[model samples]
Target: MPRLVAKGRSHFPFLALELLTFPPAHRSDFWSPICLQVSAAAFQPAARSSLLEPWCRSSAEPETRGPGPRAMEQQHLASSSALRDTEEPASCSGVKEEVTSCSFNSPLFQQEDKNGITYRIPALLYVPPTHTFLAFAEKRSTSRDVDSLHLVLRRGLRTGHSVQWGPMESVMEATLPGHRSMNPCPVWDQKRGYVYLFFICVQNHVTECHQIVLGRNAARLCLICSQDAGCSWSEVRDLTEEVAGSEMKHWATFAVGPGHGIQLQSGRLIIPAYAYYFSHRLFCFPCKARPHSLMIYSDDFGVTWHHGSPIQNLVTVECQVAEVTRTAGHPVLYCSARTPNRRRAEALSSDCGEYFEAQSLSQQLCEPPHGCQGSVVSFRPLMIPNRSQNVRDKSAPSVQQSPLLDGLLKPEEVAGAPSETWLLYSHPTNKKRRVDLGIYLNQNPLEAACWSHPWILHYGPSGYSDLAAVGDEGLFGCLFECGTNQECEQIVFRLFTDQEILSYVQKD
Candidate 1:
């Protein structure tokens, strides 16, 4: 049996059930004032398991897959009806939030009469200062990475509970003369008010496997900055030699994010990345390659950056970072990544992203066959809506009223701030394939087992995704690839509120 552990703390009263089968495990931490132990059985679906039987049958047949992008014409759709009906209602029905979704990119979208264009690898960044949401993707002639031509973007503004997004445009300036641009990773500097878009430019038609086989690095690290949200961008700057330095000699290839990065409370910027390095044999003949997730960070704002050491033990790739604060002073950098182990691998860094300590596997967050890129963002835990706000009870207090939340608090929360840091993660929920996109919550982000069972976001043909915390009013956004027969047919955006998330995780 798999074991799910949540170490540290005194009272884990409101602890959520993990989506895995294992006995509850708890460890004590001196700095943390709350600890939780809950059974995995609480999350097991009841007789309603049959409601998901159609998925397995449909997923096996291409012709019987979900309806295509055209069926999603009605943008204002409710959260998965299948879920709402099959699962027991977790909260009062009155304040339940409606999920607003829209197809931002599809073959149906005409650009100068162009058709059959495939967009993939989504990255979303939310600028709090301007209340702006920037959605980035690669413009591909075909679904293959080698066919990636350039980067494209869409800007949105938070309007009430929904978002009003503008038109899609290509980041024409984010390219080199003789290369193709892929992976549109965006990192916003909150303190400096600058939007840094980092990506890799590969020599035309050159694939990653080609570089790994020859032990050569064909991808160049490049970035473009914007001062006015994403309306305009500066020229691309090649940071390969500057940041990677002599390290490139041993790396077969490397890539940054393909998702958003984070800025810590200390004004430091960290971009999650990974590199495939050569494992040599005698005479260094036939170099073998292995992937490891690392970080590229800057302490003096975005002026200069240095790469950190990769996780040495297990192979990991395509990652995102978030800073979690404990009850005792000081913050820990949390790194979540895609791994071949079929389970999400997490690592922590006490000294920012320079180096990572112990690595743990999140048994509940299982991945597909080869693994898929996921996104994670950290935010202050929103106060659970009170009974006056149509909620079920008033006995459950906010993070402020309970000692159970001490371990989850941020540095500011320790200084009498109102809320603690919580994490929201988005990825494909299926273990057999990349379908059924879902979102998982971690109220106590410092612990690996604190993750709640995923609340399925899209029920079919879903892959590569990015999550952004929309403003601070308990709103979030997800941009992912989904379609009827295949995931690459359309890039869809969904807006959901904290109430919807909390209701699902706290349900009986």
Candidate 2:
């Protein structure tokens, strides 16, 4: 069954409302999204040409102002098709050359009913087995955090190079009476075949500031699982008492990743979270509080949960976890988090999410002012057979190779081959404002210095984002908050290839 709401007006920058609908859901098609009365808006005539026009492209001219090496390289990138197509040697600083991006100009969650309902905080989960992508966001009464009401979802099926997206559906089971559900963090468990959606249920409209000021924990850890690849969900389970234990009393408030979580190689589910530590109290009133990123993990699938130690002596929040491991090497759990500092912070865990070590700030990954939520996803580097190995195999059969593997050399053939754990990060490239959503790559996850310059994804105002590895090793899908005038006006989804990431990412 599908629920439909009346069409509502949109706020600034949008013109006409387009009521998009899908046929009612059939019980047999589990992947079909239960259409809700969701309205997609089109830009005003004076605002832009068409909603389908791409915001940016690699082959398009770079928007330049003044002269500099970076600007010159951008000019070169724009002038040369060989460079744009990666047929010739591209300069290391030609990072502005955009990748061939397919922007679904239509938002998954738009500010439908601008006077009331809005969407924010996007989280993405890709189920490899089904080649399905689940996009989640906080359906709010307004853009404000306290107005968060429901968690909505849309399922996209991978069809060749493009995705066929279903209509939006609200996760009614993820909510509790008198409480608002926020932060939709979804993770897939291949072992038990469950898609766990983790979020915080805050009572009424109590803001995080309210909990921080009074030094009281108002948020509760809750989760709902879908056994049928997000088609249906189980009842909400409150894991606050069992997971946080007495730790909740020692702090103000906490929230799980406003992004996606990770599953370790050993079948452990890691949910990134942060809490305000109640450092000390004076006159029986708590005053000092600091944020630290921590983890909630489950070893026996999603049956039981436990909290791990937070990043010691560092102020970090809104984090994501990635399990990094070299080929035939031990696994290393890496956590990157948002911080108040101008740069993001990193912590490593050798024994899974039980403990974190080597906490430090990533000078290369700059964060805007007070910081913004970013996404980190790790994947194996694209590898090809060595020439000698190819010669050895020539006698067997001649098989067609993918274009992506054409230019790539084998690890044994090339010097400085890509490391085992290559990480893809998404955040705003601007240091002052949340604009110009950029995607960064790190060939060597263990070395903070190994991060390359970002490939700007979206040019205008952008905020919170989530990245999920899709298709091959280098292909990724980004679900983020972006708008023409302000962030969070709508949640957009785009896909990027490894070749695009490598072509646009410049190493210093």
Candidate 3:
């Protein structure tokens, strides 16, 4: 049975008394009226803007007027303001962005034309915060400047702050009291509260050989400090005479090696030293076996010293050792070298700072054709959590594809493990080997399967010096020399954060 109902009002005739009523339509037609009613109700407010004034003037409602010229102008002004806000400049909108992003820093190389010949070498330790002190040998044709050694103190602007440091003071003048000319290498010792400067004084020149022109007659280690926060250093005390037979030519390079002279668990002080032979005559050829690497230990800080057995690996000169505890096992001393081969060499020492293994780890990557100097840091592996249950299932061997595996009930599952090792060094060029930073990662030492292609951190039209890790502040700082020519008038130290490295990885 079908159901029907009355819809509209019922009317009665006045005179004849007749009644009229409207009946509902079919259910299919019923929706038509309802849809029309809903659409009209929705559009009433929108239509009222245009129709309201006409309705108000024509009807008994109070008279209302449409917008005047002034109101229309104000409305247009408001619209323009809204559009302007939408198109605001990016810098003013508080969106952080990089000024320039690249993997390498540049000015890849530089050479200075002083006197008759061109002498272009990478400027060492020019950056401000990381480069506390820098020392290098410079030769001039004229006697006025002469063949002199120069040292510079680093200074620059922090990202959000301003600070200035004075020019680097001359240490060779005061330290080499008797000799007027000397070549020096300076290193700062935070633990000993002094800067240790090493230099070789010319004993006498050999006119016959011409090779032994700069034979080291005397080697002196000075303990220097400045009261004005390293601005002006006081006179260096002669610490060389304190060592036994200190007057004799020891022929060594002093470095603050592994442990940074921290009081050990055994209550002993460990300082690392390496012995090497340098000659102006042998400058073009490779180094001989005479120069070797050695370690020195002091029980009462620098007050007393005992020389340890020399490391058997004497293949490289300018060696550097870093104390690191990478895995859970034990802390090991890692050594790196800038050898004559134009490649970096590494070795590990198991014994407690006394002796190291003979075999070396070679990074076969191409180094700049000239002399190189840099450092390495061993960072812990960064682990990412796996949340999928199918990870193990996906790692299983494909039984369907292999006949040998199909016979077995279950296949073996191999999970990829995570491990990271990083190496940083200066990249050199053919004409002038400017200092630049390169990073490489590996799970195993010198193993291609575990290694990554080298990535450049900062290289530009300028060169970077040595890099230092400020663990306390989580910053990797570098000294950079920005000059059109090799002679850099202004040097600055710049700081980059750990987040920058992570961001680089993400982009790659």
Score every model by TM-score: 0.74, 0.73, 0.52
Clashes found in each candidate (C-alpha, N, C closer than 3 A): 7, 1, 18
> What would you estimate as the lDDT of candidate 2?
0.67
Which of the two, 2 or 3, has more lDDT? 2
**Segments in model 1 whose C-alpha atoms lie over 4 Å from true places:** 1-115, 279-286, 384-419
| Model 2 poorest ten-residue lDDT run | 51-60
Q: Ranking under TM-score, best-scoring first? A: 1, 2, 3
State the RMSD for candidate 3: 36.4
Question: What is the C-alpha lDDT profile of model 1 across 1-508, one tens digit per residue?
Answer: 4433323221221112232443345222311221111112232112111111110111112212565453353222421311112222211222222223332222212222123467778888988876778888888775556667999887765546545455577899999988999888899898889999999998985556445434557899998999988888999999999889988877877889989988888998888988877655212212445678999988998888899999877778788989877656678788888876689888777779887866767656797765778899888755844422321223333332222223333436444432267788998888887777888887765432456778777667677899988656888888887765566666777777787888887782
Give the alpha carbon lDDT tens digit for every residue of 284-346 in model 3.
221221334555555654456565555565444344554544323345555565443455556
Candidate closest to the true structure, highest lDDT: 2
